[model samples]
Target: MGTWSARPFGNDSAADWAYELDEASDWGVVSDALRVAAEAVPSDLDSDDAVTAIAAAEVVARGLGRVPESAGSVDAFVARVSAPPPEMVALAVSALAVAASAEGELADLWEGDPEWLAENEKLRSALTTE
Candidate 1:
């Protein structure tokens, strides 16, 4: 179907980690990624790191909804998005879209899983359009 790249999202390094989460279907890993990212957030959260953190948090949020494990990261992401300029919001949303657009061999683990796919797409659309 379609190809996706994480370069546009900033911190391509984390993209593979994100894909690994989807590929492995491990919720524990989700908690870990988000926790690590959240712990790193400071008052001076860089736009690049913020984008990466938001993208990862979006994936966890999509998978678990309002999970306690991801609460801090999700909260951080929400705060960052809310306070940023329109362009920053757009950038964050675009990163989420890129993550949602994941496909091919890397995303095969999530393919045919309608619920998971829909959740990702729903979050992606909400960020991009709202």
Candidate 2:
């Protein structure tokens, strides 16, 4: 996974996904990532897809004015893409839940890492907050 930290964009997959996000002309990229993760069979979810979905959820949180202090590249993404629709917050939350669940590769990879789990919960909290 080439992960160096627990943050959403702290991995190779997420960094690559961030580049795609920067090149995207609209919000569809974000929605597509979230939708794909959210709709995946929990037992069959890929780690790359899970990572990208979490990154996409981070973008949605930023669009909703919930930008974290350590947003990194996601801040730049928010500046380029228009705000995500309000409905996306729910989708983002759903994606996070599925991606972080025990059924997915990401969850298995992060199995004993409390820091990774905490980071995932933080992103979910950002999306669910009013």
Candidate 3:
């Protein structure tokens, strides 16, 4: 099996991504991430993001397909989209976990991070229902 890093997409730090240069510095990927953040998407007809964070997840998953193997790099994708769905946030988490699991990185990220791991676990559990 291949060795993977313990990095949840949003868990990425500064050095994890410095390739974009222009957007990588100012936006720092976080802003781009917010583009698909659960709290960022609009839920209502007026494009209201105040409804639920899950809304962002919906869009994220729809557009990004599945979370890539590196959650750290999601910001790169998020930066491009001006507005993403609410469920995208959840999509981000699920896809990132799938990516991690495939790459063997999930074990590392879940280690010692009970809260984060717990959230991931919950997301994993929810998959069965979906």
Candidate 4:
């Protein structure tokens, strides 16, 4: 996982995903990642997928005008890309739910960590709120 913190983009997988996002010419990168995670059965979702999904959701959150303070590369990606379609916000919300579910590796990895859980909840709140 190579995690240094509980922030959405605080892991190696998410940092890699952020690089992909930065290089993308459109929002499809975010949409594809969110769709894959949103559609997967929680038990079948791996840690990398979960991490990427969370990072993608953070992008969607930014599109919805809720940028997190620690959005490193994501801030640049957002500035370069147009805001995602409204539907993507819904997908992001769903992806976040699945990624944080009890059956997923991400949840397992952060199981006993209050900071991780709070960070996940914070992302979720960002996506769902106006």
Question: Considering every candidate listed, which one attains the maximal TM-score?
Answer: 4
TM-score against truth, every candidate: 0.39, 0.91, 0.28, 0.93
lDDT, candidate 3, equals 0.35
**lDDT of model number 4:** 0.85
lDDT of 4 by residue, 71-96 (tens): 66677778878887778888999999
**Model 2: how far is 129 from its true place, Å?**
0.5
Ordered by TM-score, highest first, the candidates read 4, 2, 1, 3
Clashing pairs in 1: none
lDDT of 1 by residue, 1-130 (tens): 1224322223454554455543443344444444443444243333344444455555443333332323243344433332333443444444444333343222343455675466456555544553
Worst 10 residues of 3 by lDDT: 43-52
Q: Per-residue lDDT for 27-83 in model 2, tens only?
A: 888899999899998779999999999999988988888865435556776777778
Q: Is candidate 2 or candidate 3 better by lDDT?
A: 2
lDDT of every predicted structure (CA atoms): 0.42, 0.85, 0.35, 0.85
Write the residue-wise lDDT of candidate 3 on 1-130 in tens digits.
1213222223223223323323442322432433433222122111111111222232244334443332333455455555444443444554434332423333343454666555445444443234
Model 4: number of clashes?
A: 0
Off-target runs (Cα >4 Å) in candidate 3 are: 1-15, 18-81, 85-94, 100-103, 119-130
Off by over 4 Å in 4: none
